[model samples]
Target: MPAPNAWVLTEGHAGMESQAVGLAEALGLTPEPRRLRARLPWDWLPGRLWPVPLMGVTTEQGPLAPPWPGVAISCGNVSAPVCAALRRRGVKAVHVQHPKMDPAAFDAVVAAVHDGITGPNVIVTRNALHRATPERLAAARAEWMPRFAHLPRPLVAVLVGGTNGRFRLDGEVGADVAERLAGMMERDKVGLYVTPSRRTGEDAKRALADRLVPLGAEIWDMQGENPYFGLLACADAIVVTCDSVSMMSEAVASSVPVFILDLPGKSRRIGEFIDMLVRDGRVRRFDGRLETWPVTPLDDTPAAAAEVKRRLGL
Candidate 1:
């Protein structure tokens, strides 16, 4: 018999993995994260085209043998096949993003509206799921407060995402961001908490530091401990780069106001998501102004998880 709980499938990307884990937690399930490993052309194949046996994994990776699980939450295109394989064994699969195949393959397909995936089973979410909750936020605040307390009040946390296919965080854009932020620091007298994503190359990182550090902003040197969660918990306002939906979702999910910084290119899905938040008054574009306003946090994880439970009858 399969396990009585839920399993989260991923290829090990942090953002994608977090969504699966987030949804699982919202469902009140302890997520058993399973990383999928494959090789060759088979590895590149879409879930629908994947062979029965799949690909390779070390013995230490655990037995994928029988008894998959009661429910499986999968993120990313590669993990779709793992979910599909489990579906063959009576596992209900909740897939995030366009499965890059038939929507009918899964019990429920959760996608962002911009993905243009529609079906009877498809549920659209304004943003990607995340593990931002009141409890987590409280813990983060408690743990991170004393460390950041010395910084001034009205903290502005800047979450910088690197480049995606549509847009790149090149030196030019980085300079523009630095200049704008320097202006904000000079005029607003607010302290900054800055952290760069992996996609944020050294050039962009240096650019931001050169401008923000001297102004008394606390920028993570990518060493020791990361203050990401603490910053989110403690920030009075948040500024996020537009290339990532996950970052924006986490920001707006906090009670603080979110300022979205526009990148050079465009992403239909990300754009639509941001527009929705803007209309809802949860977010605004960064215009060299740091403003704090009250609005309900944008939370979709719980509802999405509830839908999964109802559909799976768990």
Candidate 2:
């Protein structure tokens, strides 16, 4: 018999994987996470070009084998073919992001509006899918409130991301972010809970810590347990670096006010995404100040999940 839960696959990229996992959770399905490791020539070719994609598939968790899942959700390009291979065997395939193939080939495609893909089966969203729903936030707040009691009131959550190939978020850039954040502390009397991603290099972390730490900001080294969920739930306001669309999306989903810290990047898609969110009054650009407004928590993940359930008849 097929499994009772959904199979969520990714290339182990945290941002991509989170989108798939969030959609599965929205659908009330337990997510079985799978990390794809494509071997040899298969890894070179695009997912659409693979003749027998399953032959190229292997996983660190285990080998891809029989007793297929009833549904599979994939996010990254490399993981799309695995979902497609499973789809041929009666699995309902749902891909997040542009599949780079015919949208009709999959049961459903959850694409970002910036991708510019539209089809009957495609569910386009203004914001990226994330797991910061009200239920999860409530649970997180209950679990994390006591842990964060030491931090001062009017807590500000800073979701820090670092340099990618396209963005220059180095030590100098990090220090610049710190200076902007320091303005908030000085002006609003706020306490900051900053969480840096692995992409934040040691030099960048040092630069950020040198300034932010002395200003009474507690930066998470990303060493022990992650306080991401807690910070999202408990913070009065949120500021995220522009390098990560995922961070921006998740931060906006919370009830708190969200601000995107501009970085030196030429990512057109990210720029478009930010523009749409700003136009919709969901977010604002950070300019050395903390501002609050009426917040309408984003419901894009549940919306995508509803489309998946409707079209797939699950």
Highest lDDT model number: 2
Q: Report clash pairs, candidate 1.
A: none
Over 1-314, each residue of candidate 2 has an lDDT whose tens digit, in order, gives: 53369999998888998999999888878899989898887889887788988888789877788778888999888888778888989999999999988888789999999988999889999888988899889999999989889888788999988889778888788878888888889898898988988788888788889988898989897788899999999998999988888889899889888998898978888889989889989899999888889998876888788878888887
The sequence of per-residue lDDT tens digits that candidate 1 reaches over residues 145-227 is 99988898788999999887988898878989999988888899888889897779888888888888888987898898878
TM match of model 2 to true structure: 0.95
Q: Global lDDT of each model? A: 0.83, 0.87
Q: Candidate 1: where is the Cα deviation over 4 Å?
A: 1-5, 56-63
TM-score of model 1 vs. true structure: 0.92
- Candidate 2 Cα RMSD after full superposition onto the native fold (Å): 1.8
Distance (Å) between predicted and true CA of 187, model 2? 2.9
